[model samples]
Target: MTHNPCLSDMSKRVHRFPLFSITALLHINSTSALMLGRGLTQVTHIKLLLFFQTRHTG
Candidate 1:
């Protein structure tokens, strides 16, 4: 079987930065972090949402 661990980790990292930022801003942990099973765009989009809600909430 081909190993995709590296890719997975890379995905996590890429997902981590923005995700973490959004998480921090939104005050949410990784519980709501979207992975879409494994898609970069989805992950980024989710992170963006997290960021948006985080900053917009008065």
Candidate 2:
């Protein structure tokens, strides 16, 4: 199967600039983060969700 370059690029970008990803997550509201997380990889989605949850609870 052909890999999607856009997804690959995004994965790379996420890895390369993790702080930026965190910052973006912080700026976005929970609903928007949930929607955005749906498109991420399973592990990444979970990680972001946990991070978002912790930010709110802690």
Candidate 3:
């Protein structure tokens, strides 16, 4: 299979600015969660926590 340089480069950028990416993702999820309902909001929070932990460890 041919390698995709563009995808690799994008991944590198994400790893470099994990915080900025996480904040943007959280903002998007928060708005959607508000429209979805309380249950989704809770799920979003848990996902956010897990994301944060993984970012730190991995």
Candidate 4:
């Protein structure tokens, strides 16, 4: 009819660990995706600038 306090605490920790890991993974994925998007935009801008410069020079 009773449970040990230490066991209860350990069970809570075991449950919380997976939730923290999942959120950490999601945060890392979103951060990387944002950086990738910025990189692509920068590459596209640079290419457009190069194309316009070459057209003007020619």
Candidate 5:
């Protein structure tokens, strides 16, 4: 996956920087993070739904 500038910089500074800076960086890149989070949530929900449906029907 490709990262935006804020994410790249956050990765570089993650260990060196304080929590405040990290939070600020996260906010700067919140759009990407939010999208990724929603995508993951949807995938997980779909997988669980499929698993349950198969187990119940089969």
Candidate 6:
């Protein structure tokens, strides 16, 4: 049986949408994770500095 030409193009476009959205989501998640990692590192650095300063003063 011959298929309709209109649905073929439309179906391809529909399939592409999910792939674009998934990659966009990946970019957002990676950026968020990087920011979180940076924040955690800064907090750890501050804690270490404070601990050492207190030890030296005492």
Rank order (by lDDT, best first)? 4, 6, 3, 5, 2, 1
lDDT of candidate 1 at residue 39, scale 0 to 100: 76
Q: How well does candidate 6 match the true structure in TM-score terms? A: 0.68
> Relative to the unseen true structure, what is the C-alpha lDDT of residue 2 in candidate 6, on a scale of 0 to 100?
97
Instruction: Indicate the worst ten consecutive residues by lDDT in candidate 1.
Output: 28-37
Tens-digit lDDT track of model 3 for 1-58: 9999999999998789869779999999998877789778889999999999999999
TM-score of each: 0.34, 0.32, 0.37, 0.70, 0.52, 0.68
Model 4 regions more than 4 Å off: 1-17
Alpha carbon lDDT at 7, candidate 4: 95
* Clashing residue pairs, backbone N/CA/C < 3 A, model 1: none
Q: Please, what are the lDDT tens digits per residue for candidate 6 over residues 1-58? A: 8999998999998887888788899999999999999999999999999999999998
Candidate 2, residues 1-58: lDDT per residue as tens digits? 9989999999998788879778777878776878767766787978999999999999
Q: Rank the candidates by TM-score, best first.
A: 4, 6, 5, 3, 1, 2
Report the C-alpha lDDT of model 1 over 1-58, residue by residue, as the tens digit: 8989999999888866876576686754343455443577878889999999999995
Off by over 4 Å in 3: 1-36
Q: Quantify how close model 1 is to the true structure by its C-alpha RMSD in Å.
A: 17.4
Which candidate wins on TM-score? 4
Which residue pairs does candidate 5 place in steric collision? none
Clashes per prediction? 0, 0, 0, 0, 0, 0
Put down candidate 5 lDDT per residue, 1-58, tens digits, no spaces. Answer: 7759988788887767789987888787997889999999999999999999999999
Model 5 whole-model lDDT (C-alpha atoms): 0.89
> Each candidate: RMSD to true structure?
17.4, 17.2, 17.6, 7.3, 11.9, 6.4
TM-score of candidate 2 relative to the true fold: 0.32
Clashing pairs in 4: none
**Candidate 5 ranges beyond 4 A from true positions:** 1-28
> Which regions in candidate 2 have their CA more than 4 angstroms from the true location?
20-58
Q: lDDT of each structure?
A: 0.75, 0.85, 0.91, 0.95, 0.89, 0.95
